[model samples]
Target: MTTGTTTGTTTGTTTGTVRSRRLGSTEIVYLALVGILLVAGVLVAVRGGNLFAQGNVSYMLTQTSLLGFVAVGQTLVILCRSLDLSVGYVVALCSLVGATTMAGDPSRVWLGVVAALAVAAAVGLVNGLIIASLNVNPFIATLGTGLIVKGFLDTRFKGPEGEVPFAFQTFGYTRVGPVPVSTIVMLVVAAVAFVLLTRTRAGYHMFAVGGNLDVARLSGVRTSRTLVLAHVLCSLCAGVAGLLIAARFGTGNALVYSYGLDLDSIAAVVLGGTLLFGGRGSVVGTVGGVAILAVLDTAFNVLDVNPFFKDVLRGVIIIAAVALYARRQIDPASRRVRFGTKVSAVRRGGVA
Candidate 1:
């Protein structure tokens, strides 16, 4: 019994040590992004550009807020070991649907917003049901759903149509001093997401479900429900983003921002150090990731970099981020440390 106690104690110490070290490594990635942002700002400044200028900063925040909303949703879906390719079109559809509802009268703008959210929620529910119940590959399911959304939009409208209410547009443009209202919205969403993931039971279930569905199920976690919730929330985020877009532009365009938004949001989530395989991530990291992309994109424009090359650079960044995280995941030292503790626990007659 004494020997078992000693072994358990040692195992606990080893596990704690490993966790601390791993956390440090994760923090480094976020800090590195901060450094990158500072460097990018300096480079932009060196080129006689003011990255910190009031106007530019406001613009960056507004744009980042839009992308950030989608990225936050992507983070949740990925955390559940699922993907939401349908989000891009969800944005387009919500924009069109909501704008269509509000076109007749400005007083009905709130109704349009509610209608857009309902559409988004319905689409998300279908996605969750199909993938969770049928055991369909999340990637394939979401992609198919996305195509369907695109088809619906195509058949419904040829180009930009409908008008957003003037008041709604004004709200989108409202600024709190130098900060835009949209940016405030983004920050609030992020804060809520951060709290949910880090401080709530549902968040814990999501991470567990993402880490291992079978284990989560064995633990009475209701893995299917968790996954469905993730997708639902993801769609809601997309819906909000669509509304913002409609308000910002005062119209909905089926073609606008259709191509890169999905990829960009995924890239931002990955950049924030969230594992693509799911389970391990932070909303703060996602925020950092979004800022990195925003900084780079802004820098590219200010530096006169070719538009074509920006895409290439973005692809490279995504690949590099994935590779870096993969390396950390498979590191022999970390793995051995984690595995060793379990092995020791088992030898001591404990359930590893």
Candidate 2:
């Protein structure tokens, strides 16, 4: 009788623990987003402005759209226990490629997009090859790739080049009520990515590889292929961000590499409750992280805070939040202690 009771209790407890661990991290991220917004509202109010004004809301969403795309891709790569540092460079290169191809012609917009993405894909392939085939450390491989792209960009383009047709530019500027069309598109991409991560066999392999590489290999997971695919997807997302820039500015600026998007995307992924070392995260939480950053950006602009100081403040906030998140996830008491002692006692009673 006691054996059955203890077995039932242990199974229920273990299942509960697993479910909580899966959902808890994402909940914490969303709660952080809410906290950020409330604080932003107060700061904006102090400056005699409403944070939720239609204009302000549009601006924040617009910002979220751009970062959200790149961050979504970053989330995928990070989930595989790898990283991409060439995203900013990919953005700059692809933007210029698209703009130069279009050359302000409406009919050529499709051609421009295809050309740009093709280049982005090529860059991603190179990154994947270096990392997966050559066995280069991902950080060093991607960093080198970024530098090479940067050198090529600086040498070839001295200033902004090419123009977006008026129609193409509308994709960046069009809004329905307070929501930008671009934001909608970004959300759709995120939705697709979310499904890919959570509802696919490839996704399971990625999580397994990330959770433990050797174990994944032993289980027949293709670690190299997964890593390569992650980097490619990350670059493709950054390329889309580049296209957005082209649409917004009506031209491609060579200096877009200076925008620091690579780091910012990584920051969003980390802030979204993803482990730096890989495995265990969700794209939904990443959207919340992007929102938090957008809110911060909007709030600082309203407060007239110095841009450099805003960077510092953002860094500090990320550090504290990540520290707390890590603590909760890594605490053994939550996992081991809760199950270990009780299960051991139950087993001992049966043995006795």
Candidate 3:
């Protein structure tokens, strides 16, 4: 709810009551999450089980961390009116880089982390450079980059390779009072992303570019730099996910690509109510979206739903999300035609 104020020359001031504002998308997402939890709890109770069990909650958080990292990155890229289909490949590749650098050596963990992030950032740089410099369609540019990485993974790596030290493994598995450290890290990353998008110059420029490229360019925004920065940050997040993967698995598995993280990450971003084509969205809503997916996964497990059915349900979710926001693509404020309104015989107010 909000209010409006007006001032008149004769009258000192005037106020008008405005209609209550609708809930924000982020708020709606959390409310939906609560509703889902309540409903899922009831469904689980029917089977003589409790969905709110600490273990179950922790498990969901654990799973959320994995997808959350990539999804956060996806959120940034999508907000910039750009896309990176190569994130899944980056995650998988970074896992290998981190693990292989460690090579079972505990002392080299920092080096491994650096190596992975460097590789991830490099890939992001390439993606940004290609799209921004060449004016390539983001979808096609990212897809091509992803395919290149996929090819490298296929030919150079046959299976899992390298190892992670036990010390690092704890980074992935450690828990504090029902919360996994990895989840905490993910939330921290989200916080950073939120701040970047809401509080910084780069973030403002990103939204401007995504909102209207020509307007932003005319406004003196360094459009290319902004896009490149978004891509770099996006890939960095994926690198973190890779680190988590290596820590958890104790080895880098090239097969991580099969997890379909690229699409899953995108799904989370869109479900958060971000404009599909770009420009308008928030990371807070994205976090809520990730939580929603986590809750659904938990619900599915409690209900003993078949694994295959989960895919079907996920398909329905992605489609529904796209359908929900598709209407926004058309601007209602634009001129509408065929309304039978009388007009002078002129074109755009000029001589006919």
Candidate 4:
């Protein structure tokens, strides 16, 4: 009986160790980045003297709100081990189409909203179908779709032409108590995403598919459907963001948010420790990542950093984050090799 009890305790300890190890490097990077962000915010606050001023804080929140919308969708896509490069075009095209349809008519804005969502959903479906059915690489498929969307937008509008209704602009500018409505909307979206990922059957299936597509398939999870759903959801998120952008600016500019938002969203998602390969991540971590990016940008502007330098810094952060993840991927194989080499050395030593 004592032997069995001892064995059981040892097994429990082993299981705990395995679970802890699963989050090893990812957790380290996440915590480290958080620390860095906090330190940077402090330094900027001291230097700028307005980092936490109500107005500056509101501006930061507004900026983060826009990027957060895109990051949430990017997290879902990456969680499923897929990419949606079309999101940039999705934002541009949706905003342009919706604004043009509205033509500054407040009463007709709902029609524009419907058109935007429909186009967004259709784009997502095309991405899903082409990648899942045709077995095209997601990167290539989304890229192609993005180009097509961009082409359509270019043909429709040579420049920013349509005006968003004044009533619609309120959604992007209103403040609830002390908070921007955009920020509130982002919080709601993040909360919904968190619950969906943690509580729903579909979310579980998505993670399973991302972790191991073959295993998920064998276990009766519909991997193809999960992939399709992820892309569709991502596009829908972009559509929402596009509409908000149009309302905020009161006009649609195809070139305004075109590509920068995509790169920023991806960078934030990756910085939050979501593996680009998918299968493991947290929406909460993504929230932190988005905040970090926003804070840095805010600080840079306050400090009057050159635009070129800001771009370089962003590129460095993204490359560093990706490299850290890549290192983690190589660790298990390298550990096995080391273990085998050590065992061989022990055998030779014993023989000698």
Clashes of 3: 0
Q: Please, what are the lDDT tens digits per residue for candidate 2 over residues 1-352?
A: 5665677577668866776666476788888888889988988888789999998999999999999989999999899988899999999998999999999999999999999998988888899889889989989999999999999999999999999899889889999999999999999999999999989988888889889999999999999898888888888998999999999999998898898889998889888888888988889989988988999999898889999999999999899879988777675545665576577677778777
The whole-model lDDT of each prediction reads 0.85, 0.89, 0.86, 0.83
* lDDT tens per residue, model 3, 43-78: 999999989899899989998999999999998889
> What TM-score would every model get versus the actual structure?
0.89, 0.92, 0.88, 0.85
Ten-residue stretch with the least lDDT total in model 1? 20-29
Residue-wise C-alpha lDDT for candidate 4, range 1-352, written one tens digit per residue: 4444465456556655765667654466568656866776687777856666677677778888988988998889899899888898899888887888899999989999999889998999899999888999999999999888778777877898688999999989999765899889888999999999999998998899889989999999988899898888888889988988899889887985455788788888998888888898878888878887877787788778899998899888778877877777765644654565566556656666
- Lowest lDDT sum, 10 consecutive residues, model 4, at 1-10
Q: Candidate 2 — which residues are off by over 4 angstroms?
A: 1-23, 332-352
Off by over 4 Å in 1: 1-26, 334-352
Regions more than 4 Å wrong, model 4: 1-34, 45-48, 257-259, 324-352
Name the best candidate (by lDDT): 2
